[model samples]
Target chain A: MKTEDLKNTQDYKYGFTTNIENIRAPKGLNEETIKFISNIKKEPEWMLDWRLKAFKRLQVLKEPNWQKPKYPNINYQDLYYYSAPKSTSEKPKSLEEIDPKILETYKKLGIPLVEQKRLNGIAVDAVFDSVSVATTFKDELTKQGIIFCSISEAIQKHPELVKKYLGSVIPLSDHYFATLNSAVFTDGSFVYIPPNTKCPMELSTYFRINASETGQFERTLIIADKGSYVSYLEGCTAPMRDENQLHAANVELIALDDAEIKYSTVQNWYPGDEKGVGGIYNFVTKRGACRGKNSKISWTQVETGSAITWKYPSCILQGDNSVGEFYSIAITNNFQKADTGTKMIHLGKNTKSKIISKGISAGNADNMYRGLVDIKNKAINSRNYTQCDSLLMGNKCGAHTIPYIKNNNSTSIIEHEATTTKINEEQLYYCNQRGLDQEEAVSLIVNGFCKEVLQQLPMEFAVEAQKLVAISLEGSVG
Target chain B: MLNIKNLETIIDNKHILKGLNLNIKPGEVHAIMGPNGSGKSTLANVLSGKNGYITKGDIQFNGERLNDISTEERAQKGIFLAFQYPLEIPGVNTNIFLKTSLNAVRKAKGEKELDTLTFLKLIKEKASELGIDEKFLSRQFNVGFSGGEKKKNEILQMKLLEPTLSILDETDSGLDIDALKIVADGVNSYKNKDNAFLIITHYQRLLDYIKPDFIHVLSNGKIVKTGDANLGLQLEKTGYTSLS
Candidate 1:
């Protein structure tokens, strides 16, 4: 097929908006908006205080400008800080009570909320437009002492757990978007695995931005107690709009002694049109803390959406002999821009971290991998290995790697490798001679390039991620 | 089964294959021997329909004009070129690559794709026939492979793909006597009366194993001489300078 024909065939499939009554706090950001959101959730006074403090910090914090891709000015007040489906007022007791339209929307996204139609061996928390619409397999999870519910419900039922772990990893004084997410964040999935119990099933959260001009500020927190293990997956999608929507989400994870948390994300939000008219501005802050000895936190993300994506899912290795891993495949097509990578902070002895990032850019898009590996003075005998690879599909696209390594201890071992490669005609011809067309050949080659990171995802997600990688690069090569 | 008439291929505005003409019938083994820059590899590339080359010729395969079709279409019609330097595609497993390639060819031929179990069995059989172990199937395609191993892998692909017209471009380069014999045996075993072979090489060592029906001497972008297999022996003894 001609390259031109292949171009723009990857229109966002999840761009249809669900028509539903919304109970929204008036468009804007202020102390009142935070208080209003907290009041709607019926939060305690301490939680309100936390939001007010985060709101104050956000006021003082300026939107960071030190990034690769530049965008038009964003007026924060023009965006509705909180917009929840009106059906969320009286929280549904089961899937039957939830609005059928919301359930149908989830079904369209390939995430059926019905217990029988849901994915086997996985519990899903469906969050739509700042509220948890339906969380499936709740009883099954609760039977195993696994508290899996919305963050709002978690705060109401187990405030001590939410208060103890919230803001512990990412404080209100964190980055600008993170501070904002802390202030008016409406709802997200909250998972807690008790001590000595491996979670019976995989926990997943499907986030959808439905309301127009509403910023999605969802906060997700997961805590795995000592000797426990949990594998969590998060997927996001949004409707296509001419005006770019804002999504600033914050995710925090804590793994206690001998615990492990495997977090996987497949982000497929609307990436705007061919002219880059409208899309999501995804600025997310996700971090995991290995707070106990021999703990492990592994992050596997396949980011292939948003017009402008600025995210770095990082890990803080604060326990002796703890291991942290970040495997990512970030693809930018058309006029999209992605500045994503990971940060590994080694603060304990014998800590180890591995980062394998693959970035693909096509069609005037720009993709960058900005990562930092910091081994503190107390992190004796720490080791880090990072490999960042970039593949540019067309001459008009750009791929950049900015790796920052700060090692205060001489006993630490750090190895960094980066490579920038373009789709070579020779390779394409070689593949063509073996009976594959240009698109198939490009997909195969790109999949090979990202095999290391793709292998890190779970079996089902790996397949989806591979297809997304191929679709994102369609028509990227001539 | 293959014919080239007045083939003139220019790459980068520099004439590479100038009015080269050749014809091969089914069950024929043809070897084109040449020195460096003699356009032997260019002939193979052009026959396989690689891009970036301007060609003015009548190249027909199976009664169809091939110049207008894409490289993959050419392959679907039974054209295979064993690269002189096999590309190292990291993370593409050798078995998967071979399976995909074979399935692509099969699909074009209106055949069903083989299941994973069937494919694994087929590859294991073919690989062991070429003295390759199962472990090589799981590794990245040609990544960090030794020269002999790469050449053997090319032969493996050629055997599994089972093309009607196979073009082995300098397959013996960088091979030891043992590896060369194995590769030659692979090609000889794969050759049958229904198919053809076009071998492009620098020396007569490969010809010693797989006898060629015709030996064409390529010099200065065209065929200078055509003779029997003994001609290769004579050229090995008396260089191209003597022929000129």
Candidate 2:
């Protein structure tokens, strides 16, 4: 590596790549590309028809440019729609059958595909490039009537569930990136918790983007049946590359009567070098629908990566007395731009929602929190509370908050609170005078600022996220 | 020991400390008295390695050049400065801040850091000795603390860090008489043959509780007069106008 390139990989320790030969679809976005992707997965005719519909709609749909962060145009035709590890063509029944190099890559990324060696005992479905390479804890979960596997497998194994709730929450024609994802998304995790049962362990999926010039388009669908509960975790990272990569994923969740789904994501894709020469453009659309009375959904995310991240994991409260929550901590450093928040659409009576967003911007980065809460006239006596806080490290960075509220019901209550603070020299000096270095002081103060949202994560992930929060802002100070 | 020679400080092109010199050995508490705009706080800030100041000359602590050493390095080497206006760092719990600070200093000193239980016990005893409520230890660092409470917290930190050289910049400004006495007692009890103090104040009020070995009256960015502890009483009677 050149001396200049060494600095790019230092702070982002997940910058190495495995030399696995790839079986890739031809470059470009056309009917043939979509058919090729669908054909490779051996998806049923209905699934291919759904992709064709999305691909047809994508032609008339224009990309939304109303975001706070602007970027140059993306050449859709020059990008590879799908690239999977060649060995994954023949499905691996066990870890022994899986390619050794892919296993080593996961091991290097701190995700052991071996079920017995899972550090947190989480049942993880490891997705590499554009394929689901391995999934753990299958038999244990199967005994409990829980189905956790790759979406491709689900399409072939449980097509009825997939067809029933695949695009129910985030429709195929939602927006540009979402439609694009719906058309080309190759693989992601599929989880289904049977009625009246609680998942025994945390279900997790770790996404990795390795092949250069390949856009990772993953489609995830999770369904929690009546009287059931499940907590799902998603984590992603990519190898350091000089060319910008795109990751546009669509995640849909459905909660039935008395069921609840808690989804948490820790996204650490490789943000570009300090000069913003290259990184991942993470544009994802995730939404959950409360389809029956008393259903609940919570979204918690700690986003500290990507060159330009534009996502809003939202919830549609269509069930009476259903609850929705969003807790987010988005940290942007060194030319990274993140515009993320959530939306709560209340349609049922007495529904409730809460949002807590914390954004930290440093080293010429821009962070924005844009959220919306809409309480329809039918949603009588609904309540919503929102809090957004921004912490700035340098004068060059920017923090913005734009909250949109539409409450048509007189009896509904909505409250919004926001605060923006700069990392003042006095606070830094005080900490330093008490024996902390510049980076440690910044990290301590930032961790405190993010404590409210960080607490929403699981215990082990909270610690790891705290350390990642610190590592993300490594060069932000003097 | 702390040493200074011809220290000149210019902040934003305005000379604040013009050719100021001071020296103190262990077991000595020196008080600097001056009216407003006399660069009393500027001296303390420059000593603490605050940014945005242009300084010339030398500051030495135990035969080491502090000219280029960072603020945390100065602190790790046993030089502590209690700010005149201790910052209200929101969201940071007081107990956690104290533990992290204590551990950092301990680690830098080549010592093993204390466990949570031991550190908590030590901090609890220190807080009670100063009459601080135990509940205040868990609240956000100085977020809703009263002026006097903030001063006491500063004193509590002084006791915790136990630096070789401590500079209290206007520590008595917002303190009530009772709080002032407690703060004075904190300094008095921490006083030993191995540690020293430099107290900067606007009035001789704090000196009544913690008597100083030397009193320096500063005017127009310079220390115009230096005398024994009697100088404080004399200044209380005559005022700084006489020295000018």
Candidate 3:
């Protein structure tokens, strides 16, 4: 590679916003614009009416100012509410038939349409740019009565399921981002495993935001019925663009009696340039509800990208004898900022939750771990344990932890522990002395720090997340 | 193979090595005996390019100046310094670390890397030579290892890397006589006409197994006296107050 190419490689990776025809409003957000989006997607009359109600609620809502390092007010009118591959009139049935430009973008991000053949048991839905390209292993999943498809396709094929559980966990006006997602959300994944049938393979969705000046509001809903089990993985990467983009995703999951769901995310969005110019403002709301006795739901996320991230994937323990868990590793480097954690709300008897979070800050980045655990008066014998550890790679970075606990139940046990530490130079020297380069040493140390979180991922995605950690830390090390 | 000239070092604004000068030729063994806080361990660290302050010094190895290189560079150039306190690196297997280090040295020397089978054989042979159990290779590096086991593992690395200049910093500090003999025997087997040894210790017990031609007494960061193996015995009996 040429010297010039090396500099631009990092540049183009984050700045290459794809050229695609989009159905967008003239400029900003208004009731008319919301109605325009609903009309373009050809939504039913009730959905359009729902979008209007959300838009009205958004007018009264105010942007939260409690977060550290305030961002310039986002011009709602400047964002394109909708974008899709203009060349594709119909979704491709096979990986080969997908648009070449769209496929090439995912390839550059190291997530191709084809599974890394070694991981044969995992099914992948490759969503390029704005739409899902091809859903793999559908025939096999169908054999077990599992419905895994794009959310849009699910709305067309299984509307009853979508309508029944779409906004159950996160109400339309739950948060600012969730409100926006409920308004103009385009495409995400839908997974429904039938009662008593275990998912035959890990289901995954790879998301890419390829258009400039666009906001990606994808809605994902996963349902595991009685006595069923499923593990799902989600990954994302966006090409570099000078124009800051917005991603407001809403993910809701429902677990019925004796059912279990594991959701893992490796989020590597475009985190702007080293100087922290134009990148993704990733604000997402994900929540799961254990609605039946002995149900379980867990969320594990590794966030290594995004210029500014505001996310809290939470769990509502509303089922007796249910279990909830959240494992997360968030990394912020080079002017990036992350304020992420999870919330566990216990409203049922004998409910339990575990939260383990690891954050790494390098360069001049700032990261914070903010979490909440609440036990209601009816939640008898509710229990929770939370551990948050932050690793600061350099003295220039900052790490913070904020945990909130509220309990009205007399028999609840809640504990919280947090620690902030810097990577000791002596440790680096020791690792270097063992023949690992500075980058490798950092990767090794960081990986060890995050092993707990990564292990929660599906085996195949766990390996992929490990490699992403190494690549993401490149150039940040000595 | 190793030369130190008026080596003056300081750490945290306090001097550690003051006007210390020593030399070791190929095929020779040099033992440094001193009281606590003497410059013996500092000498080993300085030779291995460890970071502290060198207020005044000149170090040459194999006729090449050594102060400007990185610790890893010095290591790749056949200078091995067994740390007094080997760090515990969890999640990194001992075998992986050893192979990576060996390959780094080999690559720097323009030699072919050893394959897995050959590497395992060498490791087994070296482990047996040092009386280290085979199970140690699969365990995390230095994690949960006893003090003697850590020292032996350091020796195991030295045996694998086969550095031309080996500095054992207090390798005999926390070892029993049996472990000390095993460690000393490991060092003795690695000694050759093409390599040199710089053994730094507070006591003279290790010299009984691995004899040194020249013994030096360091006090207050400077070499105050130089003698033969008898000097170590004298220091042990008389202590540094008389020598200083």
Candidate 4:
């Protein structure tokens, strides 16, 4: 089969739009727009002050250009900073009371909002566009002293908890995109696991982008108290459009003494067409801080969408004997571009971190892995190991790895290894000779390439992520 | 049955096989012996439909022309080639690879695919029969396997696939006396009246274990002589230089 024939057979399955009235903020980014977003959410005075400060900082910040992916200038003022479905104003008391169209949208996305039809034992906080539509299993979570809700409601119901840890890990002046998100962020999920308590079930959030010409800036904050444990999963998707959309999200995690947090994400935003006309520009900042002794944090993500992706979920190991781990599989196909990795900073004694990253690029896409490992002067006896692998399917695609390691402590050890490989024609011929077709052969080989990273994902997400990996690489080889 | 007439194969603008002809009927085993650069592997590649080979021939397999068919289609049609140097595919378990190949061939033949339980049972039995450790089934395909183990793996695949015409390319190379017997026994157990074997080797040691009905001397892309099993012993006494 020809490459063009294989390309023609692939179509985005979640490209359909949901028609609903949207209450959008005035198009543009400025102090007034930030105020408008805060006022709509009825945020507290201190929260408004924080957004104002972040907006002020964002004004002087410039978007970093030292990455592998290149794109045209982004006109920040041309994008609507905030947009929400009209039904969000009147909070629905039950799933049936919610707008059927919105319910149907989630249903079509395979994330049914109806409690009975949804995956049992998993609590969901569904965020549509810029607002939270519904949060299920809240009563049960409350019974177990676990607080899981949208960030907006968390600010209203648990203001003290929200204010204590909101930018503690990732400050408002962290970076360009993060500062922007902090200023104009609308809604995201928030979880607070109490001390010495193990969460009863997996906490999940489904994010959807339906409104056009809007930028989704969500702020997620998760706090695991001392001796607590929690696992969180996030999934996102956007509608197909002729104009590129922007998604700048900020996620912060805090693990206290003896606490552990596991965060997993499967992002499938709309990638531009084969001609590279329209898609989502995903620039996200996700960071976690192990603030107390013996705390741990693990981040597992499978990124397979967006026209341009710039993300590095990082960890700051501040507690003695703490551990940080990162496992990622980022696949780019067609006109997509992704530059993602992780950063591990050891600030305490006897800290350990491990990084595993797999990148697959096909079609005309470009994928890069840029990671950093820093062992501070106080981090004696610390150890870090990093492995990054890249697989290029077609000649036109590109894969790059840039790793930076700095060890200030004499007793610290850091090791970094990287490899770039192409799919072997001999291997493909061998598979073909065993009665497997071209696509099946490619899928099998690519799956083998990404087996390490895929094994890190949760059970349900692992299966979906494997399928996404195969779908993203369709028509990449001839 | 397999037939080839005026078979010529050119790779990278170099003619590797010039006017090669051969015919093998069912229930028969044929051994092709020659020195280095004798186009033994090229014939196996062309017969299995590998790329980068331009051919001028009328090759018929089971009464159907084989040139136009794809590699997978040819395999589905019951043609198997045991590679001289089987590629190691890391992260693909041996059991999974064999099961997928078996199911693909079965599905193409209009047979029900084997479930995990049935496939495991079949593969374990085959592995034990071939003297392969049960632990080898869980490892990556051919990765970290010794040369003898890799050859055993190829024969294990042939047993599971149950192809009508099996071509063993250099199956005897890099094997100890014990390893050679295990591989030969694997082939002997799978042999039947409905299937045929084509063994390509550089030595007569392999033929001593699995006797061939006919021995063809392949030299410079074409067969120079044809004889019975005694011909293999004669060539062992006098190398290809004497035959040429």
**TM-score versus the correct structure, for each prediction:** 0.96, 0.96, 0.92, 0.97
lDDT of candidate 3 over A1-478, digit per residue (tens):
2346436534434446566565455567877777776665566777778778777787778877788756788888888776677655467777777778777776676664674453567787866545676787887789889999988788778878988988889987887778878887877899999999899888889888876777888889999999999999998788777767889899999999999999999898989888989778999999999998999999999998899998989999999999999999998988899999999999999999999999999889999999999999999999999999999876788999999999997899999888887887877777666555666677777887787888788877887788777667666655
Where does candidate 3 clash, by residue pair? A14-A239, A14-A240, A14-A241, A15-A240, A15-A241, A16-A240, A27-A77, A28-A77
Q: lDDT per residue, candidate 2, A1-478, as tens digits? A: 2345435634588988889899999999899999999999999999999999999999999999999999899999999999999999988999899999999999998886897775577999999999999999999899998999999999999999999999888888999999999999999999999999999889999999999999999989999999999999999999989898999999999999999999999999999988887899999999999888999999999999999999999999999999999999999998999999999999999999999999999989999999999999999999999999999988899999999999998999999999998888888999999999887898898998999888889786888999899889876776
lDDT of 2 by residue, B1-244 (tens): 7889988999999999998989999999999998899999999888888888999989999999898888898899998998899988777899989999999999999999999999999999999988889999999999999989998999899899889999999999978888899999999989999999999998889999988999998888888999999999999999889888
Each model: TM-score of chain B? 0.98, 0.98, 0.96, 0.98
Regions of candidate 1 where Cα sits further than 4 Å from its true position: A3-8
Off by over 4 Å in 3: A1-15, A20-25, A115-120, A475-478, B13-15, B90-129, B133-140
DockQ of each: 0.76, 0.75, 0.46, 0.77
Candidate 4 lDDT over B109-207, as tens digits, reads: 999999999999999998898988999999998999999989999999999899999999999999999999999999999999999999999999999
2 or 4: which has the higher lDDT? 2
Native contacts kept, each candidate: 0.73, 0.78, 0.25, 0.67
Question: Model 2, chain A: how large is the TM-score?
Answer: 0.97
For model 3 the local lDDT of residue B109 reads: 84
Residue by residue across A1-478, what tens digits does model 1's lDDT show?
Answer: 8645654466677999999999999878888898899999999999999999998888789989998888899998898988888887889998889998898899899886789955466788999999998888998888889999999999999999999999999998998989989999999999999999999777899999999999999999999999999999999999999999999999999999999999999999899988999999999999999999999999999999999999999999999999999999999988999999999999999999999999998898999999999999999999999999999887888999999999999999999999999877788888999999888899999999999989988786788888888887777777
Q: Is the docking of candidate 2 incorrect, acceptable, medium or high quality?
A: medium
